[model samples]
Target: MPGPPTIFVARQPIFDRRAAVHGYELLFRGSAENRFTGGDVESASAINIEQSTAAFGLDALVGERLAFVNLSRGALLQEFYRMLPSERTVIELLESVHGDAEVLEACRELKRRGYRLALDDFTDAPHSQPLLAYADIVKVDLRQTPEALTPGFTSRLRGKRLSLVAEKVETPQEHRRAMAAGYDLFQGYYFCQPEMIETRDLAPSQLSQMRFLAEVSRSEVSFEQLEELFRRDVAMTLRLLRYLNSAAFGWRHEIRSVGHALMLMGVRPLRKWAMMMGFLRLAGDKPHELAITALTRARFAEQLGPPAGLEHHDSELFLTGILSTAEAMLGRSLRDVLTALAVPDMVRTALLDGGSRLGAVLRIVMAYERGDWPTVESVRTECAVDERALTDAYVSSLQWAETSAAA
Candidate 1:
């Protein structure tokens, strides 16, 4: 007999103008298939939500922020969203859902219950015009909404009741244009791109983080050296010990010193932990979501390392994933960041060219982050891992990132 279905869920952060995460658009897949191939999308969505919420509390995936969940016409009519807390859930009506009387009545009922409504893939078509009346948010796909139309289009939609959200925004320029066009909310991976400032020197704090990351990356760094490095920075030392002593580690006794923590964790684990801390430090003044994104990528790549045939190179895999966002975090080119850290050729190549098995793992992880399941499948096939493994790795990585952030 076959086992139960494998559910895949990944979140895309939605940001305000200040770049702070306002909520997440939870992308769900009922099976390993990249796209919903056959079954009723409504049933699949309802079942996936039931199972995901029961198995892993909604709090686990989104924390305290709102969860933007997509719903089909049937799911919306059936009131499936009622299963979730109305206050924290944003009922996103898929573009396929029509705005007829029944649909509008369903939306009105949802509004009466204090649930916000969002219209996804919004367009200027007459079919979508009626939705503007009830929708609290209108998500405009910038890719489909032509550049010349943005100013006038956004101006037309700008109103006191509804806020405009710029979707598929992928660069700093796109983000700026969206803001200039009066978009109140923004989506997409634009924040992940490094803002390159020509001829700017690295900040002193970032330079210090680089030195620590470089030291940990060295193959022969000793416990004493690491201890001394931690010792020099009292705040970092406390954070390291505090993290080790957290419930996630579950040490029988309280970890007292940097030396004790280093000895217990050994070189490999210590290196990974220090690298994570280093990344957090390097991510100064950036959105908290950026740090979580890097951490999730790190853990996801690390979890997939063995399956991707890099079992012995987990440290390098973790580094490859975490540093993938270094350019964005530190405002330097990826090449410069890698060169400064003097990472191994394997890690450098993986981050730069996406070459080698390490690169395959990083590719899969990055694609999964964007809900690009087709690319995930292509790379997963290349790596010879099954869909369940990737999905499981992603779920666990999400949990691990949440824990690590709190720690």
Candidate 2:
């Protein structure tokens, strides 16, 4: 009745291809007092804008690392985009929006202001003609359509412009079908699956960032010195604060700089966060969904912590587990990925081979997600954490994330 309290980004088999996750759609469900909106379309229309938009923004800002949400054409017409951060998100025009002059013009204006636009479930329609001019990405629903018809339809629309994005892609086969059909972007569950390809190069900026963070985290630098290190990288500095001030940080006041962040975040948490920051740096958003999923996994692993003393090994465990989907993230080999980044050999073994204590901890984290209580229990016994303790940790962490954190 309440729908899900939240829509979780389903993390699955990391597929063997390259795709950037621009943003995700947030489909809504009504409050207890309100009538339900049937179908993702009419349901999208049934809302009171001021209430739901604010709620969605507040919820997303608090819970996620920047995500893109869908706004109904009516919502879009109302200029809901004005209220949210334009760069960090994309305004999706639901398939239900008619391709017409007013809508198209409004879309152009949003684009002019630096907002990204996504066209959903496109087919060869006269209405879509105008919309595609300004649409940055096209989301094709694979749940209802097969691949055979994609090429002609997409070719007619794409014609040297716009990337065709295959959405609702749920399996490895679906991924293959979409890729073969020339879909420039992909979304779905294939990220969890093992693929034959090796790793690829991350953007130069991303590489430089991870290298910098790795050096900073490992340096004999003081908190004061750490401030200078972050200052050297403006984007990284902003992200660290955003992540810190986010509901994720569990802090008490406004944090102004890297040194302040270090003092509040502490050495262990700082190291864990620095590695996470490193991962984000290494994987600067090219394969967007994979990046988001990896971010989730890293956050999950960080919250779960590592087994005591393989000696400062938990941070490495967090790094490895976050990268478990490396193959799917970049459609390449795990070994190749490590080599490209020059990741240490120890991390290479734990992440790719899935050997060692770190690997075992990762196994438990995955098992916990699958609701495999017994396997979780086995790992818990091995790690010296009891079931109750693990449950408590999860609850406390969620509360901390939801309430005390400020970045």
Candidate 3:
């Protein structure tokens, strides 16, 4: 028999009106073709449904929130969704699934069994009525629906005891429009894009963190220098001591001073933790997912370095990944954000121009995050990395980020 098929999976956050993650839409493709072809969708969906409900489990993808799984007509009729938990799974029907009698009855049965149904890329087509009547959620594709018609289109879907989700919202303006249009949930990269308004100067604490990051980014920074930086910032000092004493570190003795903590963690490990803390500090009051994404990308890129022939520059690769979202957190352009801090030439080039090998690694990490498998495949080949290695790195990074963020 053939070995188990490769499953490429990525998740996009679904946010509530308050910008909190409500769930995630799991995006997956059976192969690198990037689009559903032949029996790929059905076969992949079946394997995922089984794995998500058992074995690996949904906790690997989403801790405890709902999982929105796409279902083609064949999967719906064949009851592949039955393998998933009704209360925690949202069966999202593809647009190609018509409201024929068979599908309508299948959706009705799903509702009676307590599974919430969602209509994907909804545009009020003639064949939508049968399935629409049973849907608990309707996703409006903002890219296709147009801003001028958003409110009117969403208004008709409201007050029917169903939530309206704004899909493909890519900017702050689109996010605001979706909110004004009464979309209860949002899905896209709006939160990851910088708000295009008057950029505020970095706060004193933020500035201090950036300076600390700059100092630590160097491979030769003295521990005393790092400790002095921590000593100047009372909050950083307290955070460092507290982190070392925290249960995650399992220290039998309390770590009372910044110097002792820095020495104990050593140079390389200290650099990693300190940089991550700095990123979290820069994240400030943004949604928690931003920090998580930064951590995930950082780890993912760091792991890719060895495979991509940049083994000696893992630290810079990690820096490149973490700073990838600086613009989103700082509310400034990427160039402005990078200018405020010091980074190596490779990192700067990767962030600014994507013209280096480090840039290629960053691109692969990003494409993998968005489930843009075609780009991922091309970039992976361009970087000369094994596909399985990339998949393992991403999966491990996701788990690591969750634990790291929680700690």
Using TM-score as the measure, which candidate wins? 1
Segments of candidate 3 deviating more than 4 angstroms: 1-6, 31-39, 147-149, 192-407
The deviation in Å at residue 366 for candidate 3 is 53
- Answer with 1 or 3, whichever has the higher TM-score: 1
* Worst lDDT 10-window in candidate 3: 194-203
Decreasing lDDT order of the candidates: 3, 1, 2
How many clashes show up in model 2? 26
lDDT of each: 0.70, 0.54, 0.71
Note each model's CA RMSD in angstroms: 19.1, 19.7, 19.0
Deviation of model 3 at 156, angstroms? 0.6
Full-model lDDT, candidate 3: 0.71
Give the best candidate by lDDT: 3
Put down candidate 1 lDDT per residue, 8-105, tens digits, no spaces: 56667889989898988876654444444655565455544543343334666677888888888866764656556677888889898888998988
Instruction: Flag clash pairs in model 1.
Output: none
Candidate 2 — which residues are off by over 4 angstroms? 1-16, 19-22, 31-66, 146-150, 189-407
